[model samples]
Target: MSHALNILKEVFGYPAFRGQQANVIEHLVDGKDCLVLMPTGGGKSLCYQIPALMRKGVAIVVSPLISLMQNQVAALNEAGVDAAVLNSALPVEEAQIVEQKLLAGYYDLLYVAPERLLTKRFLDLIAQIPLALFAIDEAHCVSQWGHDFRPEYRQLNVLHTRFPEVPRIALTATADAVTREEIIERLVLHDAEIFLSSFDRPNINYQIVDKINSKQQLLSFIQHEHLHDAGIVYCLSRKKTEDIAAWLNTHGITALPYHAGMSPHQRALNQEKFLREESIVMVATVAFGMGIDKPDVRFVAHLDMPKSIEGYYQETGRAGRDGQKASAWMVYGLNDVIQQRRMIEESEAQTQFKQIATKKLEAMLALCETNSCRRAYLLDYFGEPVAFTACGNCDICLNPPDSWDATIAVQKALSCVYRTGQQFGAGHLIDILRGNQTIRVVDWEHDRISTFGIGKDLPVKGWRAIFRQLIALGLLTTDSDSYGALCLTEASRAVLKGQKKIFLRQQPEHKKYLHKKQLANDCPILDQGAQQLLDQLRNWRTETARKHGVPAYVIFHDTTLMELVRMNPQTKDELLRVTGVGAHKLDKYGDHLIEILRIA
Candidate 1:
């Protein structure tokens, strides 16, 4: 443990372990297999990394993405750790060099994709070298039930069969109970000790708004709060991703589009720009974000609902990774629910899988509609206990939504559904309730029904909210047989018969809650002179990174730079005391930084 702590401080520039990092590292050092379930940016790497350094031989890390392997290897090397990566992206000669180095025991940590590691050539090479441990990153990929299931990950059981003596560690940022069990079973880690970190990311404020002029709302979010910050905006479709990216660019935000539809090189270049630039926003589908290791993402906005709570959690987890204040804003509408349901029903997955997917979507809807602490609701969904009723961070807790007796409104909506023979979706039902005399309404003679026009007091948007809440509460279900028409379940009978009273949030006017309060003092605030100093330091960092052909963060993180601004260290000795300034970094940049501080 002492050795690990020393490496952590001297190499990674952290003074101590966070949460359960020490315990996990200690267990791994003792040669025990382990499973770690931690949120993004919870330092999962340190759990395996310290053990690899302490053990007798090199550590082999099986990662699912080439970009992720490259990013980790780069960061490790920057921190003075001996690490290398082998993937298809590597040149043939370079791959041969890495293989030879591995055979000669020249590397401390070796990262390889699962497919490459499973190859006979690589397997033969590993057999010739002394083994330390196997670290399986993004371990949820092993679960067929997970959102990011990779078939190659399922065949990783060969690791246990071929190298029974090597300690193994599997780590994932997002996984529910089902995915967790599947990871353990598929990876043959049944005897591994499990370490579950708190899934809470307190720095990220969760906000979900009813979709209204979504593009404009997204623009407002960026302009008002995160104007100069880096963020990720997620869209459901590839076309939407491209459209939004172009839209954002026209609106004066530097944005890029990324999806599987684009060429691999294009996607990689866009991802690199997003990582390397300070304020570039990447609008992408679910294809992005799995391998992103950026710690300073200020926000993650979802223009559409994700497929499941697990997906939502993982996507939102990308924000505020540095433990700095960030936001996860989502705008979803009734159409999103219908689209998700239709996708699930029309999917090629088996009946059981479809049912599970439906339930997952339902849970996501529940999170959107809940008037409680968003953080608590999200944590509870992951089977973690929340000690408090309110998180004081989400929009609901901050604004405190007002609930009204929506019993009468719900009854009218349900009655309209039943009167229409449960054959109409929300649009038709809402039109019928709001007394819209459309051709379809008159053609079906729906205006003549007793429940028709009864909901004229509420507008279409209000009625939509009521129906969405009803669906979320399980009082109403979408029937795929009827083309996603509204159907009442047994729960709806109670509301219709006045046996259950439904209290729903009174739909706010103008969507004011979507605007989050700008956090004051979240980051280090500088005086006029110090602010200039900070700017100069950033400029220096950018130039240095350009010279070295690396991200500015690889030179120094924002937090470290902020610390330099605050401390205003005048000498190399004082600069070394900054949190992230280890011996290697000091020797590299200490003189230049001291000169800047002295001038400022």
Candidate 2:
């Protein structure tokens, strides 16, 4: 029983430590370095936060996003911790005041952006203060191989050089073995203990569908599964983000667009609105969602395939952070695959890097096309094996995809590519197989090929699926020299000569679940009495948050408010027993809550 555990219970209001939190905290409190690979909402902040409080002085947190710092500092202050952030967003006078206070030892924790932390002026200022530890959040950004690489983060090795006496902790929600090694090497945490929590997010239902009427499909998903919930819809381009946001708004959903193209003020305002309000969907490119700490995001949908599995995992990890039932829905097609391949080939990265990028793209495709347990495949990608056979929560486990022996169809598709001299891409090959009388097919004389019109029994999408699976299976390769022309690989010869068999998933029918008046019964629901109290509590919270100019979650998370409603505590002592009601919060809101509970 250490003081850290006591602080966790008294300040954070959690009765016990989850998973390896206590171990990580103990290691850090012992003045040692650590690399923590916990899930998004697995209490990574607590590991360093508790140790910082229990140790000598201020804990400096290096974060990538200003919003992340603001959100975290606000939450810490709400929990009765003296925390502040230093970033360019602060005015000159305000920054001077904060600097003076920081020098006077008035703050327990200080959050700063990487660029600001690396400044000579800030470094000199920190030298005068007794420091507790250095917490490098979103540590994967230090690796070039990571999806969200920040070059500024690479310079963080200066921390080890400058503050040799202070301990450091690097934390990330997403990182594979390769990225993990890179974080340790780049951050110079060679002797740090590594804590790799399970990456399994069972509360999020994984659903990947082949693209068909993508906008309609997205609308259907929103209208049915995640209606009236806060979520994020990721797009590939800036223009697409704006278009989709507008479309969603036209259909009676409050939506906003966020991308690098937007002005800084506009992006900040939109993000603030999303965090403060409910049922607002943010349509954005990868420019958003690095350190968004919003806990109530109910879903994350992707209209395009991510460049790699790491990117997909990190993006989807944003949802269900509050441990609520959420959805990770995506729609991809062969076009997305081709476009991603083209982008990779056109990049200026070195040849070896290009090869690595191509392999990652193929891995993402495999996850999409996998008919087995999606969670198992995903966890296996990160080098973690689960004991269970099936996750029972993903789309694949709920409705097993149909598979057909496509030995003959695959051979026909490969032969068509070979006969076309491997000069045509999937479109021309599909045209040749489906006997499309397109001018390109006619000019190439592919209509007279032996494989021509032999696959008319299958539709164009079906043939495309076979070719994509062939590519994924390594039976076919894309020739970048010829602008993505299809080429038969050595493995294709066995399938063509009847020595090998191929299986392909039958194209699933695009079925949309009907919009029910409410979500699934299994999800957290309120009875009529509790619902009335919840409504009143939400109204009070919104007003309180507005007056204080902080996000509603800072005042109290929706989960805490719901607990108040369910318990219907009529007395101040009873209200203190509710979860999330620590001494500070209980004193702040106990009377108000008890009054509302009694009136309801």
Candidate 3:
């Protein structure tokens, strides 16, 4: 059997096993069951993948996503390993062929869906094989508390009970303490070794912006910061997904929308297009989750707020999965909070369940409003230590926002609601501030109300900011059933009565960058010939990766080339010392890159 560290270098192209990977691999090889709670991009696949190749028989991988399964299978095939996935997309003949391959021992790993486990034919076939291990990907879905709960996942214990001697490993990128315990119970890993890697990805910078012309803000961010990077823009609804995707396409971005509203063939086609293409952005909804396995996603932008932190974490984790620098950005507003609360309140869940869900939703809101180090807060929440309080990548860090005491402004807004019978939206009230004397105000004859036009002290934008912040802070609530008409919740009563203080942060004006001339001055690496060499290496890597049908980094990592830039190596022996350059890889690719460097 190959050593786990060596396997890391050979198959996955890493120089060393990340924290807990080696330990988990050892436990798996020793035929002990394990539950691994690794953050996304933390290399959870390696723990079972290495053992699958080294041990006696096929490793059955139960995966939740068909597209993700296909991506992984393609990657394995590119690495010169035999792998196949059985999913709904397969034809009868193709399914039989894969089944026959499994029985004939031609495939090292078999990716199957949970629904396939209960089939008599498949179970009988599995009984005949000398099973090496069982791997459950996205195992958090087994629990109702999890963001991506799957009813079929609860039936996975059959694999454990029937193949008691075989080792099992359950893996998930996002799971809190409750979900973790639920996965163990549902999977029946009674004696399994548990591997809990710190759920932290330091390379990702998290930022949340209060919703203001959110589409324009998204466009500006993409144009300025992520012009050449692969990204995913998440919307809460299909219409918005399509609209944003169309907007991006109109503005020279190669973008597509994927949601259940699209035809299945179109969804599959769009997903395939994203996987095969470079620098493409996918604008999608929550329906696009569970099966997306694209590495090197530069950023994940949430145009609308998610239902819970677990959902947000899992979605954002898709970025920086290659362990490179990436970002997570969100735009949120008062309407999102109201709609989310209404959904929770209307659900058939018991009061306790609703309370738990509400708490999680509030936590997500707090994450949005927090002005502290986005990275530090996120990492600390996931149970990790961060030495720095400011990460310098978020909106709060880049341009620290100033706050003003809005006690009076909030009182005016709330008083207007109280005097107007709590039945007006933001636009109607904003008109009163600017003294529009509109027809509605005239009909109500409310232009003479005590609080009418009282907010003239602040700009229209300022009022909008106060209202949004107030709504987010739970001091005011919007009645969504009434087309988002503003209302004073019980929490708002205190503020209107001057029993509490109100503070609102100032929003920054948007800056648009119109010239690429600044690009040459932006990257210090551009001045050096080494960067040109690195670009050539990346180009060659992309082409070579396309030829092999794998992610570009799988062939040779960017970190490795950046090291080469620093080391300026000219010999194969020298190149091997660079991180991520394995001996097997050195023998295969070292000469080519070394030759290119010499020419440069």
Candidate 4:
């Protein structure tokens, strides 16, 4: 234990382990298998890292992306640890040298993609070396049920069969019960202990608003609050990413587009800019942020709704990773709901898969439309207990929306769907209810239907909200055979028969909570001189990062810099006492930091 604490201070420069990090590390160091569920920036890496250093042989860390491994290896090397990567990104000679060094026991940790790790030649090489442990990062990818599934991850149980005595630890920032079950089954970790932490990021403020002029609303959000702040804006399609990026750039915000459709080189370049530079927004689809190491992202904005609560939680978890204040802002509307359903209906996956996906999508919609505490609902979805119903941190808790009895309105909508031959999508139905005789409605003579104009008292947006709630409530479903036509489900029968009452939440107006309160997560603790000093240090970091060709956060995280600004360390001893400033790092950069502090 003394050895572990000494390494924690001298090697990693942390004063103590956070939450359950020490317990996890001790279990792993004792040659036991375990599974860890901690949120992003919760120090999951240290759970495996210290064990890797303390154990007898090299730790083989399984990662899903080359970029993730590269960044981690860079950071570990900066910490003066002996880390190497074995992936296709390496040149042939370099790969051979890594293999040679592996056999010679020169490396304490090795990062490899799952594909390369599962190869027979690699397994054969491992047989000749003394095994320490296997660290599987992003372990949720092993679940076929996960949004980011990798087929190669399913075959990783071979590690257990081949090296029965090696300790294993699977770590992920997001996973529900189902995904966790699949990961354990697939990874053959039935005997492993489970260490579950609270899946909550208190510093991240969650906000979802009705989508009226998404582009303009997004512009207002950035201009009003997050101007000159680094953030990410996620779109649902490749074209939307491009469109949004171009539009934002034209609006005087520096933005870049990234999707799978872009060329690899262009995508890499954009990603590099987003990481190395400050205040650049990356408009991308879901392809951009699995293992992103940047810890200073001020916001994560979504222009579209993700398909599942897991996906939403994981994406929003990216913000405020430095444990400072950040916002998870999104705009959702009826179109977002329809688009998600249409996607699920159109997928070529099996019926069971579609069923599960639809269920997940329904849960996501519930999150979007809930009037209760967003944080509590999200925590409940992950089976975590929430002591309070209202977290006072989300949009709903801050500005509670009014709810009205929508029973009669819901019945009228269902009757319209039934009378319209169940072949019309939301637009035509909405137009019919609000008494708009579009060409198609008039061509079908549907204006003569009994339910036509029955909902004339409601506005178009109000009717749209009701229909969205109906679909979310399972009272109405999109027919898979037709072109996203609304159809009444078995659950709809209860509402139409007056056996069930429906209530819908109104689209709450943007109360300008952020602007009114000026809720900058990173602002409260900073004064004028401290802010300038932080900026100076950031400028120095950017120059140093550019010279090393690595992300600036890799040198020192924003939280560590904030500590420096707070502590104002003047000597090597004082600087070394700061979190994330290890003995090795102090040896490398302490004198320069002290000189800066002295001058300031």
Candidate 5:
């Protein structure tokens, strides 16, 4: 057997490694340092995991998230591996126990937070162990230029200085060229093979909707898209997280809130509930989903714009980790752009950091507003070449967007912005277009202009689209603090006074897929009778999974139960023939299936 295959089957219970994991593992196992860039669900863990399992001594993994450390340690224990974690959550005696185990070489893997590793006592204890390799997860945090940066990561260079003989591996699911260079320099990876995997997750369906009653849109999406499946809803603030979580629960969806503000126990309980599939959604700020090892998350919804495309990609990639079909849906508005910019402008980062953040925000905005394939743009940002024009999975790909000659409309919007002295945002501009005699307009005496009501032919939504497209096209600028005030760009001179013709796609009213009917023939077993049986089976499965603290599928797959309901199989032999029902599972679960089928 190949070395990777052996590790996969024996250690990970798989037959093969996915994507570029095998190549990465080989480089690390050969005593070479590596810088690996893979997508979230792209099997990044195994790149270091398999190599760690194969190495001579216990591998020390430096991770940024303490919760993730506990999760990984639990997962490793379930896989029958000797693993332990060092964090503040443990009591002194428990921590001492783990330390003693480390000294006795009792663990095959040790996961530690970067901050925890920097302590003098921990470093002294680590010195006594026969170290195999050093693995740094979320290595992007080492770079000050990267999102999610930790000041403690820069101190990680002491690993190289202190343990010169140990091979090191740094891994992150998101990083651009600038962040990549910073990670290498900050981590002191002077000689490391860089293994970059393709960033495309073809199984994910990408969709972006205009921010219209965003709460309703999110609820509608959760209800209709994949009802009650495990998912995440990322809000940009703590208040939004709490409100959204409460709203979802009141609407009958089991959702929880997670943020750094919550007590550690509460956060742990919520995270544990989500991982155990007792909760269907986790409404969170940026404090969720890093180093989450859960594999069956079915969707990720963003109620606000992320700061960068890399952040968006990494956040969305958390869905569909099992390679099953999933979705990445986002709701964004002009204010999101300004809010993000304001955050960067207020930060203590250098000028280069500000520029990079601004450019990344623009790239993300372009991706959202582009009439082109969303997947293609995302892949291109990760430095992957894409010859395929349309991926047929995203909203833009499935239904072609409509383009309109908006030369007159762009001219009207720009003329209004310029005539109004660039002091208003899209709302006032839209009101002006729709001929609303609001007090702001009368106070500014803007009603006398000829271009004031010329845009009356376009609806408010249409005019908003124009303004968004104008910002994206660089024909307009938004004030960072005042939340999307419309200001003219240099390109505005060309379009405002008819010096140059402008073209813009009409903003779509509702995405076409939202109108699509459920497939008629996909699952014929969803009829009334079968549905009744399915519900009973679901209850049974949920109880069983809860009792065992595993995902529902671990108890019984939906497909298997659906088939049994459809076939109404009365015997073990008949039940065994259904898809996903192996002999052992049939033997264990056969009687339960028969009991449910008898009632059906």
Candidate 6:
């Protein structure tokens, strides 16, 4: 344990271990298997990294994405650690050289994707060398029902079967009780210890808004709060990602599109640009962020609804990774709900898969419509219930919405569905209720129904919210044919018969987000001269990173720079005292940093 602490300070440059990091590292060093469920940026890598450096031979890390592996390996190299990655992205000669180094015991850590790890040739080669430990990242991918399911991950049970003596650790950022169990079962870690950290990201402010002209709403949010910040915008479809990216770019936002539809070269190029540059928005689908380790993402906005709470949590978790203030902003509407349900109904997955997926989606909808604390609901969903009802960080706690007695509105909507023969979509029904004599309504003689014009007092947008809530509350469902036609569910009977009352949440008027909130990461503790020093230090870091062919944050995180400006360390010894300055980093960049601080 003492030696581990020394390494944490000497190699990793952290003064102390956070939460269960120390315990997890000690357990792995003791040659025991375990499963870790730490949040993103909670120091999960150090659990195995310290053990890998202290243990006998080499640690084999099974990752899902080659880009992720490259990022980690590059950061490790910058930290003066011997790390290498073997993936299809490498040239044949480079791969062969890495393999040769592995045989010669040259690297302390080697990262490989599951597909490459399970290859017989690679497995056979590892068998001939001394093994240290096996670390599986993004272990939620092993669950068959997980959001990011990869079939190859299910085959990782062989690690324990082949190398029974080696300690193995499976790590993930998001998983429910069911998915968690599946991870343990699939990874064959029944006897392993479990370390579950709190899933709450206190640094993130949760905000959900009505989808009123989604593109414009998104533009407004970004323009007001994150115009000059780095963020991610997630779309539901490939074409939407591209369209949104193009739209944002035209609006003067430095945005790029990323999805599976793009060619490998283009995708890589866009991703590289996002990583290398600052103040860029990445418009992407769910495929873009599994292994992204970028820590400066100020926000993650969902333009459409995700398939499940797990997916929502995973995607939103990418923000505020550096423990800075970030936002998880979303705009969902009736179409997003219908679209998610229709996709599930249309999928080729089996009955049980669909059932669980439906339940998960319901939870997500309830979360969106809830007038209570959003953060508490999120934490409770993962079985980490908080004692407090209001977290004060989410929009609900900041500005509570009103829950109107919507029973009459709901009854009117349900009756209209019944009188219209339950074959019409919400748009047509809303039109008929608002007394719009549309050609289709007139052609069908729908304007003559008693329910027609009944809801004239309510605006179109108001009715849209009520119907959206009804569908979300399971009082209504789409037709089995995957059409947009609204059909009353069995649960709708009570409301239609006036036996049960309904209360629907009404979105509060847009609160003008303050300009200070826009720069949540801005450090007020630093005066004008100190702020100038920070900028100069950033310029130096950027040049150094460019020379090293790595991202600026890889050289020193923004948080570290803030600390440097505050501390103003003058000597090499004083510089080493600051956080994130390990021995190797101190030796490599300490002189430059000292000079920068000295001049100030």
Q: Using lDDT, give the best candidate's number.
A: 6
Output the better candidate (1/6) by lDDT. Answer: 6
Count of steric clashes across candidates, in order: 0, 0, 0, 1, 0, 0
Q: Model 1, which residues run further than 4 Å from truth?
A: 509-518
Cα error of candidate 2 at position 531, Å: 0.9
lDDT of 5 at 212: 74
- Model 3 C-alpha lDDT versus the unseen true structure: 0.80
Report the error of model 2 at residue 297, Å.
Answer: 0.8
In candidate 3 the C-alpha lDDT for residue 136 amounts to: 93
- Model 3 per-residue lDDT tens digits across residues 1-600: 357766666655567777898888888999999999888878788889999987899999999888889888976765556889998889999999999889999988999988887787788999998988999999999988778889999998998778889999999888877788888899897787878888777667676776878888898888887897889999988999999999999999999999999999999889877876789999999888565667778889999999888899999998877676677888887667767877877789889888888888877877777756666777777666777878766657765677778798888888887888878888788777666789999898888888777777788777777777777687777674666678888888788778899887777654233222333343345446777887888888888888776667567656677777778789987886677676666776778879887888
Residue 574 of model 6: what lDDT? 84
TM-score of 3: 0.89
Candidate 6 local lDDT, 1-600, one digit each (tens): 999999999887889999999999999999999999999889999999999999999999999999899999998898889999999999999999999999999999999999999999999999989889999999999988899999999999999999999999999999999998999899999999999999989888899888989999999999998878999999989999999999999999999999999999999999999998889999999999888989999899999999888999889988989998888999989988888888888899999999999999999999999989999999999999698999878889988999889899899999999998899889999999999999999999999999989999999989998989999899999875838789999999988999999999986887788534645545466679988999999999989999999999889999889889988998888887788899999999998999889898
lDDT string for model 1 (434-482, tens) is: 8899999999999899987888899888988888888888888888777
Which scores greater on lDDT, model 2 or model 4?
Answer: 4
lDDT (Cα, tens digit) per residue for candidate 2, span 1-600: 478867876787676898999999999999999999988888899988999899898999999999999999999998899999999999999999999999999998999999999999999999999999999999999989879999999999999999999999999988888899999899999999999899888888888988877898899899888888999999999999999999999999899999999999999999999988888999999999888888889899999999999999989989988787788899988778877888888889999889888889889999999989999999999988778868877878776889999999888888888888998899888888888999998987888889989999999888888887887888887777788898888898888999988888887665555223223655566778778778889999999999888888888877888778777788877776776777788778778877788888
Candidate 5 lDDT by residue in tens digits, 133-243: 999999988877666889999999999999988999999989988889989898889688999888889888899988978998998887887676899999999999999
TM-score of each candidate?
0.97, 0.97, 0.89, 0.98, 0.88, 0.98
Would you list the C-alpha lDDT of every candidate in the order shown?
0.89, 0.88, 0.80, 0.90, 0.81, 0.92
Tell how far residue 77 is off in model 6, in angstroms.
0.9
- What does the lDDT come to for candidate 4? 0.90
For model 5, name the residue pairs that clash.
none
In terms of TM-score, which candidate is strongest? Answer: 6
Of candidates 4 and 3, the better by TM-score? 4
How far does residue 147 in candidate 6 sit from its true spot (Å)? 0.8
Model 5, 356: alpha-carbon shift in Å? 1.3
Tell me the RMSD of model 3 versus the true structure. Answer: 3.4
Candidate 4 weakest lDDT stretch, 10 residues: 513-522
